[model samples]
Target: MITASLESARTVLSEVFGYDSFRGEQEAVVEHVVAGGDAVVLMPTGGGKSLCYQIPSIVRPGTGVVVSPLIALMADQVAALENLGVRAAYLNSTLTLDRVHEVERQFLDGELDVLYMAPERLVLPRTLDLLGRGSIALFAIDEAHCVSQWGHDFRSDYLGLHVLADRFPGVPRIALTATATRATHAELTERLSLQDARHFVASFDRPNIEYRIVPKDGPRAQLIDFITTEHPGHCGIVYCLSRRGVDQLAEALNARGIAALPYHAGLPQEVRAGNQARFLREDGLVMVATIAFGMGIDKPDVRFVAHVDLPRSVEGYYQETGRAGRDGLPSTAWMAYGLGDVVSQRRLIESGEGDEAFKRRSMSHLDAMLALCETVDCRRVQLLSYFGEDSGPCGNCDTCKNPPATWDATVEVQKLLSALIRLDRERDQRFGSGQVIDVLRGKAGDRSRASRHEELSVWGVGADLSEAQWRTVIRQALARSLVVSHGDYGVLVPGPAGGPVLRGEERVFLREDPAAKKAGRSRRGGPQGRAAAPIELEPADAALFEQLRSWRAEQAKEQGVPAYVVFNDATLYGVVEAKPASIGELGGISGVGQKKLDRYGEAVLGIVSGAGTSDAEAPDREPG
Candidate 1:
């Protein structure tokens, strides 16, 4: 029976989804669920996570109930599935009463292969009663990390999902998430009542993503340069810390001739929906948003995700960056962090209404994030270690490509601390980073002159160093907790770890920022940060790829779905490389499932046979 079920899974994978073989633990997950066992899956984004349950939903009897938190993405998910010829529908607030009745009718008649519902809707008595009247194949809980109150993006609705196990006696359950620490994983198991389910945790490493974090130096300008030089004319996302920041940055990028749009909860519903739709349907448009955007987006060609400010937690950072490179192509996870980000994040946590334990948890998360930014070691190593995964240096990240230098900044820190202490003791005053840096660099600005900072003994002491260098010192000091920014003004003060450094009892080492280098130059002579294509296509093949993309775009427009729903970029690349001349030959490619072959195979074969070195333009370059 197990062997036959596994064979059925393989058949579903090839015929419906158009993939030849399962990747990683996909086959194991499908087989377990198909055999009526539960599963808890921790696979990274773009790691083909949906297939684990999607394949089982097809091979198993009855409809699969998918409880999801992303109301906005349910339509897109169902649309993608429907394009593959699967019987999928979703129940959400966006549907009219008549449409809702039709969907419920489909579910009761066993017409839907898979059904998606928000957690709130799924937990209601009406919805539960409806499910009881139908034959359920399985229960798949997505974004299971939302159950962890300590984690970022917590949703109260997810806490009620434990009822699934109790209500649906023998129905198998699967909980999946792309980002989770050991703590979050434990909480997910406990909260979802999946203690006895099999656990499948994939590696957290995304080798195709080249991680690059830079100290904030004219951050907006820096971002512009990074986008233009590394990922021009590519689809990407830029995350900001505030709604105001999102709006301003989007305007700036548009002024600079980049097609950028803003998305946040603050926007009107229609505006946000419009911007999101355009981002999905159009190519090469940038979405500048806050943490409110991008939870379960299925767009497969996002080439880069840039952050102009420090994220509050490593888990949040990982989840956001995972949205890029979903096509398994080379992509970039780029961030620009500064001392202000540190102070602001700390202030927000301290000033929150949460109780003591909650405050402490938030602080711990921040400390880990700070360590990731300031580490002189490989960033990938530190990141994976946070998730309890071990890995060696990834040569693709910025640190591995160009390692930074470290030096003993103990004396420098002592000097900076002494100045802060003298000001509080002598003048009974405290100031923020700008004032303190001025005191260190001995810049006699108006505020410094008014405060008589130059009259102190430490005045002109750090004159030998530049303002930028001193700011770097302050940033490293804050990271190490040798100094802390406190109160609304974010005044610098001695931290718990500062006492030893003040007395010369302990030495401090800090990473020295490298000199700025020209953009668009790589270790090799190729263009910097460009994603390497899977196959180096000949000029004729490249033109053929472009033709295929044009055709796919037109299809997507007519169908009102994301282009990847018709066929992802990886599939197109495969088609061009293979130069399949017949329907049978095209069906042999990885993404060419039986449904797609039956639908578009003749059109594809025509493109291939007719694509004999016409002057079609080359496809846009891939970004890293």
Candidate 2:
């Protein structure tokens, strides 16, 4: 059992981790785990989930066994911990046999406080036998959602983790995941055998991330425009769907003088690792990679995450996009999607390996994601709602914050849906969107001639609309549930709601798609003439805030973490607003927990009280 006193724990936490107190339920989680209770933590990406287990591991009686999936993450965590003068090590494929044996000896000798390993390696019979001899303190399963079949990163080896608890029945266990829906959470608990575990869920909302989705047109140029304008000299990831696409895009960006690198499974393992390391170590390096990379990357200053192609599901998109803005400073999540993305993804699902039920579920997820991409409402509200969270219209995303003028497209929608139905009946529902679009515009392409579909009644009915406009109409039709993609034939079929509308018994309301604009141009007309800048704060207060920010950044850099993870903007704003003059006053400010106060309180309060005045004019500071 753990033997450390609360005072000792607090002292170590402040001295080692550079924080005065834990955030949110971190203190409670540490106490519970240290007392040998099982825990399941569902915290957001930047919510300090690691502290819950890390603190207990230090204070608890035996060495902590942390199961992590990514080698990069293990290295980063070990590096950060060692920077704090903590005894931590990770065993993975990257380690030499001698190093692994040495670490095992250290674990047996109770010299190492925390050790990280991949689940695949940890579940080995030899490894399990070795662990059986040690006094296991706690078993932490990081990225625990990988145990769920429904998760995007599901791994078969994760199913073997439950045997650890069976082997060490008395040891405390903590499972943590950065992203999990309600269903995923349920699956995680059951699969990990954490039936009696306490659940700690931090808020999933990311307020600092500004979300944006532009229709895919001239995508390469647009991507170049966006990266150059908004995120110049910043680290970022650009995701592509195919390895070939990754190489081509990386080369293209390089040709355009961007420091871009390509990463995918096709590359040699060492090459991939080198590119990934370069991306992490170098600023302004854009890594164009397939979905395989960046899963557990801990790079905090990533200014943006852009997707040139559509992700498979909303969960995948959300998790990928969440990598940005982790520093709590301004960051962007941008994606360029088109109808072709929907077609290609559906094709992949239909042709992939899975049972019928699984395929259908995958398709449903894709459909929901498509709806989200095309939604005209606040993107954040819709996204949060999918995760079973409620959020007000976030005035930070593209739609809610910058609504474009929309015109009624009911007539255009009716025309497009009608054209789809007429073509289906004429061609026996075998033609794809391209042929359907051609028939609708009365333009007879080679495929249309081969299929002889131009003789249909609706062939010339949509002649007034251009091809782009017609594509928008059909996309909206799918989004509105007036049409669905038939998996077997790869054709558009009228949905249940579309049947009545086709019979003229119901009217459909559709809004015009926003006109394509240059990347980063405000859709709500031009910028509301720049707002007047606020009057300057007293120079002393302004100078103090600047010094505080610089100090925070330096600390974060020294520890190799995102700056906000040390102290968020909200906390800094509190310091500026409240001007706490003492340790007690600093502790009372929001986010200034016990660990933080003890670590930096004296310095911060000194800066606050010393600003522009001698001790003569010092005012009594109030409680937060």
Candidate 3:
């Protein structure tokens, strides 16, 4: 009854998923898995990861079982799949016992094509027994990086997933993740037992999302300016480091009429669920939350992801920032970074309960993030390079537009490094950046006097720079591995990497402190280049685009799903521009599959033909 070929895969992609062709590695991943081969797919978020296996299940002879961590939205995804005329259902805790039995019956009777469940549920003996009763096309492990203890998002339940491999030897298992450092990638492969699987590592670049990092000068006010100016009347996310910051920032934004809601682990589970659902359904609502939120959320229209505080690692930042602009719209990834963030992150790492090696790894991660934030090169290049991918400078980031002012900090850095050496030799101890700065500024502070640091030759040598300038130098030093922030009291010690800079063998260049530059601010948005810019509809088709969008919104609300789930913005642009007046022409459109054309072709043509009419009159079926 089913055909297994590339042609069949293409047909299923167009008809069932409403996609015209396979993106980057989707086709290869699908073909490999459809032929009963394992894979570890390293595509970016919104790189169409779901379709890699979804189509194989359609082309192959059995149902595909997906293990996902997002318990709340698995039902919504099933709803979306069923909307496309696929026999899909989820077996999670949300279903009643009888309801679960109904789905199970559907599977047993071969009525269901795909079944999604959380990892814990799928690992249960009863669930395994149920799967054993039926022929499984493949086993897809979503968010597979969670199996790595080296990852920040490690889950204990995911530790049980390796059993799936042993239980189903011949079944193809595809492990997928959006974020993985080299180490995490190896850990994912080993922990999930997918060593021989073909690795499909996609380019980890979110080009539609502009990257920005601003000095935290009155961060709250600066954040207000950014949102009110750039992202008014748009849904976005603001991430804070602590639960208290989440609550306070949410309240502050609400007071300013921003319509924000707070979400964190501190809240009750029901409240968190409610907040998440409301964020999904509502328009233009800003969700202020801690990193505890947004692990598995699939909302597609988040216009920006702003950080009031720095995230723990570059991986976390990449994962978090990828949440925005999922619809491929022009969204932003903005953050406010200050020296205090550096100190706080250092303190947390030093005072953390993890073992020494874990703490060192975490500190290394934090240093990578700091390097990203402080880099004068393209943020996109540095970010992708961290994941073992190479890319040129992306003109979309703040660095490309306002290109940071670089100072020849060789002599100044030599002075700073000399001060550290002085502290080690003269004081017979290491001091934190604060005491070092005080000594360098010729200030007789209590600590400086207690340690007799004034007698050192490096004392007062950095007086040519202001206190803030010196702090920036120190921050940049830490970023460049010229200094280390470790020990119990967050002391500054020079690492071996600083030897060349201290000996003047290597020239050091640092982005100048923006505080010194008054006219040109570093935190402004600029024009960017898109990787694949969508073709815009002509002016004559403007009304039609809005009409089509309105119909889409009403239909999405009717179905209790996001608008993008119905039809993406690019597809709508095609419909308006091409002005398809029949099912054949509709099928010619990119997002219009055979199933979609059958269901919504008449509705789309009605919008195209009813030109110059009041768009207030809604169509019965929407054109997505």
**Highest TM-score model number:** 1
Q: Which is superior by lDDT, 1 or 3?
A: 1
Cα lDDT for residue 582, model 2?
Answer: 70
Clashing pairs in 1: 18-593, 332-624
At residue 136, what lDDT does model 3 achieve?
88
lDDT (10s digit) by residue, model 3, range 1-624: 333588789888877766778889998898888888999999998788888878887777878999999888887788778778888989988889999999898888888788899999999999999999987889999998899988889999999999988999999999999999889999999988999999999988888989999887777787777776677656789999999999999999888877899999999999998898888776668999998888767777788899999899988999999999877778889999987788789889888898999988998899889989998889899999999998898899989977988989999888878888878876788878888888788888887777777888988988878888888888888877788787666788887689987877899888975662223333232222111122334555766776776787777788788776677776887787688766677888876666667766676677788843222443454434
Instruction: Tell me the lDDT of candidate 1.
Output: 0.87
Error of 2 at 95 (Å): 1.9
Taking the tens digit of each residue's C-alpha lDDT, what string does model 2 give over 391-501? 888899988777754656656666667777676576665566777778878898787788777777777788888888777777767766777676655587666677677
lDDT by residue (370-478, candidate 1, tens digit) is 9999999999999999999989998988889989999998889999999899889988989998888788878889988888888888877788778888888998898
Best by lDDT: 1
Candidates' lDDT values, in order?
A: 0.87, 0.77, 0.82
Task: List ranges where model 3 is wrong by over 4 Å.
Answer: 1-4, 417-461, 486-500, 503-505, 515-547, 598-624
Measured with C-alpha atoms, the lDDT of residue 514 in candidate 2 is 68
Question: By TM-score, how accurate is candidate 2?
Answer: 0.83
Candidate 2 vs 3: which has more TM-score = 3
Clashing pairs in 3: none
TM-score, each model? 0.95, 0.83, 0.88
The per-candidate count of clashes, in order, stands at 2, 8, 0
